[model samples]
Target: MVIFGCVGIIAGCGSLGLWLANRIRRRPVELREFLMALSLLDTEIVWGATPLPEAFGILKERTDAPWQGFFADLQDRLQRGESASIAWNDVSLAQNSHFCLKHEDWQVIRDVSKGLGRSDRQEQHKQLELIQRQLALIKDQAGIWSEKQAKMWSYLGFLCGIAGVLILI
Candidate 1:
C-alpha cells in the first residue's frame, strides 16, 4: 500500500510539474505580441509632434492586454529621456522579443537624434513587416509545442490510469 501511494504521489507531482513548465514556457509568446503592438504604436506616432511620453502613455492606456509590466518598464525607461533606439533595444531583450533594430532603422533614428532631418519613412513599414514575420514564426512554434504537449499529457494520463488500475488490482 505504501509503495502504491508513493508511486501515485510521485506521478501526480511530475504531472503537475510538467503542466506548470508548459504554462511558463508560454510567456515568451505573450512578450512577443506585446512588443509587436508597441512597435506599431511607435511607428504611428513617429511623425507626430506629440511628446514621446504622452504618446507612450496613451498607447499604454489604450493597450487592452496584460502587458502592464512590459509597458511600465518601457515607460520608465522612456521617462528617463533615453533615446527611442536605446529604449527599443531594451524592450527587445524581453522573452519572445525577436526584434533587432536593423542597421538602416538604427542609422535613421540615430541621425535624427543627432539633429539630422528625419530619414525617409520607408523603414517603418519594413520593420513592421519583420515584426509580423516574427509573430507568425512564434505562433507556429507555439502551435507545435501545444500539440506536442497535448499528445504527451494524453500519454502520461493514460499510463497513470493504467498504473492506478494495476495498483488497485
Candidate 2:
C-alpha cells in the first residue's frame, strides 16, 4: 500500500511537471500563431482593403483554435455594431485566461485594437508592423525560456516526487 502510494505520488508530480513544461512550450507556438494571424490581417486590411468584420471572418477561417474562436467572437461582435476597439478589448478580457501569453504580451495585444478601425490604412499598417515586431521579439524570448525551463520543470517535478516519497518513508 505504501509503495503504491509512493508510485501514485511520483506519477502525479511528474504529470504536473510535464503539464507545466507543456504550458511553457505552448507560449512560443501560440505567439507565432498570433504573428501569423496579424500578418494575414495586415494583408487583408492594407492590400485587399477588406473591412474589419470581413477581415476577421477570413482570419477566423484561416487560423486554428483559440485564434479561430477569438476571430469568430470578434467578427460576431463587429457584425452586431460593436466598434473594433470595444470588441477587441472585450474578447481579450473575456478570453485572457484561455491563452498562455504573459502580461506584456497581453498589453501589446490590447494595444492592437486602439487604432484598428479608427486609423487610416498606412497608420494601421504601421501599427500592425510594430506589434508584429514586438511579438516576434517576445516569441524569441519565450522560445529561449521554454527551452531552458521546460526540462528543468520536468526534472524538478520527478525529483520533488522522490523527495516526498523519501520523507514519507
**Which stretches of candidate 1 lie above 4 Å from their native place?**
1-8, 14-18, 24-32, 35-43, 46-51, 64-66, 91-122, 153-169
Best by TM-score: 2
lDDT of 1 by residue, 30-105 (tens): 5365556646554655556455566567667766454544455567778897866566556545522332223332
Distance (Å) between predicted and true CA of 21, model 2?
A: 0.4
Error (Å) of candidate 1 at residue 124 is 2.2
lDDT of 1 at 107: 32
lDDT of 2 by residue, 57-107 (tens): 999999988889999999999999999999999999998888888888899
Highest-lDDT candidate: 2
Alpha-carbon deviation at 65 in model 2, angstroms: 1.1
Q: List ranges where model 2 is wrong by over 4 Å.
A: none
Q: Scored by Cα lDDT, where does model 1 land?
A: 0.53
